[model samples]
Target chain A: MSAPSQDLLARMALTFEAQQFLYAEARLLDTQNYKAWLELVTDDIHYWAPVVESRERRHRAGHYVAAADESAYFDDTRATLGMRVARLGFPGAWAEVPPSRMTRLISNVEVGEQGAEDIPVRSCFYLFRSRLETEEDSYHGVREDVLRRVDGELRLARRKIIFAQSVLTARSITTFL
Target chain B: MTFDVSRLVDLENGLIDRRIFSDAEIYDAEMDRIFRRTWLALGHESEIAETNDFFTTWMGADPVIVSRTAQGIKVMLNMCRHRGGTVCRVDRGNAKLFLCPYHGWSYNPDGTLKVVPGLEADYRHGIDPTQWGLLEAPRVATYKGLIFASWNPEVEPLEEFLGDARFYLDCLLDRVEGGTELVGGMRRWIIPTNWKHAAENFVGDSYHAAATHASIMRVPGLEGAGGRVKDVVGYQAALDNGHGVGMWMASEDNARGGYGHLAGIDDYLKSIQDQLVAKLGELRATRLTPVHATIFPNFSIEFPFASLHIWHPRGPLKTEVRDLTIVDKAMPAEMKDMLRRHCMLRQGPAGTWEQDDMDNWSQTTYSSLSPTARGLMANYQMGMGHEHTRDDIPGRIDNKSSDINQRNMYARWAELMAMDPPPPQVPAACRSHSGEISR
Candidate 1:
């Protein structure tokens, strides 16, 4: 009926479409189809998980791992991610050989601001991941994503995860969360 | 029955009887002796450097709140005296006072009871606030920003507790001007193994590095760096107080030379070398390169990598491990970021190295629970007769990578377990409005 209403409906449709793309990406991870999952990311994508501490600006006050000083977990280019994937596929990636079955439950989808190129985009995710080997194995965190539309196909330009639990229960994080 | 302590003395020769790991009675004795008496590492001083800052953790099975007060740092029992309710809930934060959720009782960060809800009108004279503050741990002390507390008052002083291990620690901690700081947030995970397994792994288990992390070494560009998956050249320093450090020497064939073989270790280590040579002479500086050690029961610091401190809280059949990693305050931002990534990738709940270790640890616990596996013992016979007293070094330095550190740990465990129960301290005299109660 009205031009403004029509524009609002069209925008909503694009947002929903972007949300569906994220859900599909999560499904690929849950199924351990990392090859298909890699196809969803841009070539120069940054996957970072910054360690959040109790105190502000005090670098060493809260970290609990040897490598906490310098890098984010999974800080890598496409090349590094490929190397990790290759290691997983290797016959002796002992950590993942008898791969722990996982389920990545992503929810609370909401579309956010569009990027510079007017790439139809959104950001919203809560990933609750669990490995089937043990009762105490689980990880749940929120992800802030930047999606870019290339040739009418949505792809992840960047993803930053912030974990809710200060103390993790999983024995080892062999799979992506 | 012929009496012989030799069977129990396998620990002296760096040979641990596997029974100590799976025995219910030994674990129970350890709770009474080791956990109850020793000055357990609670948290770092930096965790609560400012007043009102607090961190909640467990000392053995007893929940504890380590807080910074106007007076100083205070480690108190987390349980409220009134109704056993936890005074602080969140993992950590800055709070002036802690108010119990079950009841409205409140306590200052110093652990003094400050308020009781709705009490003035009803039996005001009977309720004395002074007697109801959170219970203070018997002893609290710090060594180079590392905080430790003891439940038993009769336990030895902190310096004496550290004993010979202090000499080795000075090589790492004292080398830096302000000492090292913990970076980012702690990467904690629950490994299904007993605490001893994790402690021994870090203490003197360079022997397993090559095999456990073979894939990490296989990474192409990383092969040149001496940080690869090989045990290489290393020496184990076993101290008098059951503490020990393993120093891995750089391979002689490496073109770069010395500790330089490690990845991203150039600047900070060079500074450490300069400081160590200034303080402890060239020989000690060279010998102390690549030092990683466990402080008694569970606290371990790996110079150049990160500090690891584990708290072992045991149930009848399970052990909960709380581990923290420490990085240097002076480290470059990029290095700190790389170290954190490396930590998560290798040791966190989802690290490559941790995966193999956890599987073994869990299986060990599971198999130990089986009926048929009840009396069987895990072997620790490596380097049994091969170890000898070295005149040049201070502590017992084992020539090869061996299970001597684990044996030393169990020996200390047995010593603590066999010690006489410490005498209880006199309770503070209770004061009532009517009069003071002597009881």
Candidate 2:
């Protein structure tokens, strides 16, 4: 790979900014400031966690946690995500009453080709998570992001996280990864 | 030190000595006599149908790689013999040899140590590579596509170990054509509660459906789906070797009524019912319904929902549960998608029902550790004296969702705990003086 062009660097700055945006988002999540966090994404963004299986000899199989054919953990449109965020804010979301603390570290930033005015970026992320009043839990994975520069600001058009641990250690992923 | 056998076997009343749950001594005995001795479900054979296919999972905290070889599916310890490093670290992938990241020592898919990083000249044949592959789990066997492994080499064959459970499983597994293929991948999560809670919950606790998942019934489409929208009916049947099955019938009159009535369920049964009836005949298909049951101790199959094989490892003050859910392979792409969606919504980390269950389970463990709350008995008395022994079946049977299943589980736990040497006892002062703990 040759050195990234200045224009690409300028474009990549949004990717870097997107990384920062994601970092700030993680902080909001860790602190359980979900209402403030909800403003960061577009109304149409899709959040997903795909489940993979290790078939003997075949290596990795199956995609999507439930399965792509099946419903998703949160196959939310912006509206559904909003509703979920609202639900989390309620006092009765017992799973989050104590609230889970999360720290998402995004690194290894690499910019890929631009598609229809949007640049695709890939980065490695390690999430150090802990829930209050419980055992320490964490998740690490790689993030593939598609960023759209909207009105001079980078917004996450799409974000897909492929986690390394097939099985989660947390009591429940009540909060977003 | 040995457990007080007399006190542990109080079957009349469901009171188990509080010592059973928190005692390190009892836990260690269980590891040997129960976890090690039983035919523990490893992974589905469908996972390793082809040579070199492999899946990494834990069999009672022992990391195991279930792989397919020329001979067939085999379960081997994930730890390399050269060093204790995990031979295959990636959750699942294909490779003819498992190369250790530490020293670059490699082993064939068959688990034969094949290469030593510096062995060409450094060792001069001093190390016997043939004997240094991953250690084989003592006993590995399969019933239908469900593969099981045992640490004890002398454990009985999977068929004999399954015994009467086979009758139910055959109906569950063989009834479907081409058997079942795991759809999507297994939804894995860690729960803070003991594994027994999960086993018993799925085994026969249909009574909790109306309450624990009352919200699900309100999900619009599912309200009148299976006639299961309202009152829950419980049916329990205990199989041999402590395995059991339970049906939360739609109603008492229609014990197996509305078997194929639920939205996702009716579709699922329609897709496979004919093939299953063709393969296993009507007798078996008619007897089974959309139900969930355990293959003793750890493995559980939830028909029309998900199939979970669990591994519960007890730490000093904590417990970790690993669950795997499987789906059918032949269903339409759209239906499969719906099934996966339903499962994720209901059971995964973000699942609605799972969220509540995890909270309860975690709180159970957390509260059980309180010094002031210690010894508070956790009640399992949902339905008492409702259990009866059937002449044809191997274990007990009950009319409704009763603690009979939980009692059966504890009964097995007590049995396993008794089979091995007990751990050193703690002083009287350390013991909780409280009567019983409640969740």
Please provide TM-scores, in order, for all candidate models, with all chains considered together.
0.85, 0.78
True contacts kept of each: 0.44, 0.51
lDDT of 1 by residue, B283-335 (tens): 55554354567887767766555646564655534555554556666667776
Please list the C-alpha lDDT of all candidates, in the order they appear: 0.65, 0.65
lDDT of 2 by residue, B1-439 (tens): 5667447546667665544555566566566567767888876776676789887877765677888899777788787676568888766656799888888888899888888877868887877666566777757877777788887776778788888776666655676656666654566667777666677777777776666555545443322232233355546876666677875434334333344434556556656667767775554443434366787777776665564657466553345554455655556666656655555555667775567667766666556567655555567776687768855334578865677777777777677766652221212333235421100
Q: Residue A167 of candidate 1: its Cα lDDT?
A: 58
Write candidate 2's Cα lDDT for A1-90 as tens digits.
Answer: 899899977876765776687778778877878787777676677677676444344322433234444323455556545655655655
Against the true structure, candidate 1 reaches a TM-score of 0.85
lDDT string, candidate 1, A1-177, tens digits: 646688678778877887778778878887778899889889988776654434322435543222323324455557666656655665556766566666666676666656564343334344444343554366666777778877778888777766655555556667765
Total residue pair clashes for candidate 1: 28
Cα-based lDDT at residue B359, candidate 2: 73
- RMSD (Cα, Å) of model 2: 7.7
Give the CAPRI rating of model 1.
acceptable
Mark the 10 consecutive residues where model 1 chain A has the least summed lDDT.
A63-72
Docking class of 2: acceptable
